[model samples]
Target: MATEAKKSGGIVETIKTVVYALLIAGIFRSLFFQPFWIPSGSMKDTLLIGDFLFVNKMTYGYSYASCPSIRIASLGINIDAKDICGIFDGDNKRLFGSEPERGDVVVFRHPVTGYDFIKRLIGLPGDRVQLKDGVVFINDEPVQLEDAGVFEEAAGPQGPQGLRPRCENGPVGDGGLCVKSRKIETLPGGVSHSILNISEQATDNTGIYTVPEGHFFFLGDNRDNSTDSRVPQAARGVGFVPYENLIGRADRIMFSSAGRSMFAFWTWRSDRYFKAIE
Candidate 1:
């Protein structure tokens, strides 16, 4: 009987240890980092579908966008689950960290949908932004662009079918899409990143837009395919994302897979493992 009791106590202790470990891991994930996997080709070429990565939670410090009031944060509560941002409703000064820089890949809450969306930061508060003939113009002058050649991609089971920005012209392999004209765009501070150019797309041109204070403008790397700041929120576009909506920057790709299931070891993208998001 005593041996059975001892065994039961050990099992209870093991369960408690696991529960404590999970709680600690939850706190670490909430405070230090956030793991996410790319589900769409929106940030493609830079972050492909199935690319798993971590967002530094502290990168922008504690903000209403991150959690509930700093008060609850101190109480060890989950901010996002509590809908603190929606309840408080306003701009929040970052408790720490720096502002988003040009050409940064940022993760943020979609203003209208509340869904987590990732895009490249383009215009800062008060910066003039425009797109003309498939080129991005900031402060009246076009951001520099140079030809970078083709970017090809195979469609995933989850990806939309047929020709898209990632697979612009036509078939690549058995069923892949390829873009023959990709351009490397250099931001003002010399931050360079590649952008796709589909001259036929309507978003390729736009009137000059002055970014409002306390907000930032964003664009997708797959320029012609993304519905970002250029689109209105009512129509499912992000529009001008408020400062409070800022989440964190994605720093690296932890892993990637090309298959439908994440556990499919045969579909692991070996080349993209541990790749940096540039």
Candidate 2:
């Protein structure tokens, strides 16, 4: 027949141009943008552990887990695309965006393991927060550190080879996960971040947290190894994060890797691709 009907009409027009290019790339990643990956270092050196950012889902208004996976998981919608359009069913707000100051760097939907994490936005909904001995008071003032020094690392209990919550990576136990420390804060709008402390653990002397009403008080510029919100969602940490689990504002990075396999293309990191998440 006419050359097998012209190869079956060029295979049905190449499967309808790949289903119309996957529905225009799923409506351009569910409207506006979203691409995150920095497996974990808890925002180290401002985000490293193989950084790879983008998130800016209209800057703050798109929830329904605003594209983390955009939900549908067997009806539970796990993996950070949390509560799918129901926004946890109480109308958790944030439908038009804006409001998330302090130091920014966020990426949420993790009100207690909904899973997108990524911190930095210290207290805002009623402030009063504290840390005293390790410094970081708000509403009472102390929010301006200096000593930008040590922050070394390398003594694995599993990290750097893939970097993750791997045993919570700290100068923890068995003498292997090395880390040195010092100050480097500066958030009152000026930004200036950096913090580590290999010494005074246990959330570095907390106690006086207030911050309620709409909730939000994150942290994890690696201050003594983060669990966030001063660790307390029944102890799994990252508590007090509502405002409907706000999920955006990571700004830029776009690519990096020390490769434990993201195809391992020569362990990438190529000058940290398009850097700029500060």
Candidate 3:
């Protein structure tokens, strides 16, 4: 009976250790640091598809606290479910001394699908954003662009292995559509980044949009390829983004992989590591 009691005690200790380890990891991932995988080329040339990144959760204050899971009502009607989940035993307020700044790369929950998306903050609250003939303008000041040349041809399976090339690049039909690479010209107020223009003509044309109060205007670095605020209202195109939906700020690229190949972990581009976001 003595031996059996000792064995049971050891087993409980092991279980407690495992639970503590998992809880620590969960807290770190949800609050301070979280890993994100780039699933699309929408931010190409800056952030490639398959680029695994680490977003700094502390950059814009803790969003999970400010925006707790509360069921929102329409006008005066009560809703059944909450759209967001609050942190357990955590204060629902912005305690950290941080705020979203213009030109910062940010991650946020997509208003339409509730999925997370990463984009650069181009226009802040009450700022006017416009695009004309492929040129972006903020408050009537034109955003600059420079020629960065083309991408080097890399040989590989033309499409995902053993799959028909549906719609060109992938099943979503945006594969290889916009391949042109260009250097981004720095805009006024210290905003600068690269952009990819697939076609010579500006496909996304939108009139002046004044960012609403407590909202932001986001745009993908791959301007021509991204479905940003410039799209039509029916497709959930470019518009104001609520502040509560922000997840965090993207600070650095942790690792990058070529194409959609997962097993080719050895083929990760090591030269791009520790590079700062522009």
Residue 59, model 1: lDDT of: 78
Q: Kindly provide the TM-score of model 3 when superposed on the true structure, using C-alpha atoms.
A: 0.78
Ranked by lDDT, top first: 1, 2, 3
Q: How well does candidate 1 match the true structure in TM-score terms?
A: 0.85
Clash pairs, model 2 backbone: 155-176
Indicate which candidate wins on lDDT.
1
Question: How close is every model to the real structure, measured as TM-score?
Answer: 0.85, 0.36, 0.78
lDDT of each: 0.77, 0.73, 0.66
lDDT of 3 by residue, 1-278 (tens): 99999999999999999999988976786678767777765776678666778878777766543232223455664321133344421332354636688888887766655557788888888889888877888899887777777543232333223222212222333234423557665767867787766554455567898887777888887776676666644677745667766768887887777645644778688877766777
Please say which candidate is ahead in lDDT: 1 or 2. 1
Clashing pairs for predicted structure model 3, backbone only: 169-175, 229-238
Against the true structure, candidate 1 has what lDDT?
0.77
Query: For model 3, what is the C-alpha lDDT against the true structure?
Result: 0.66
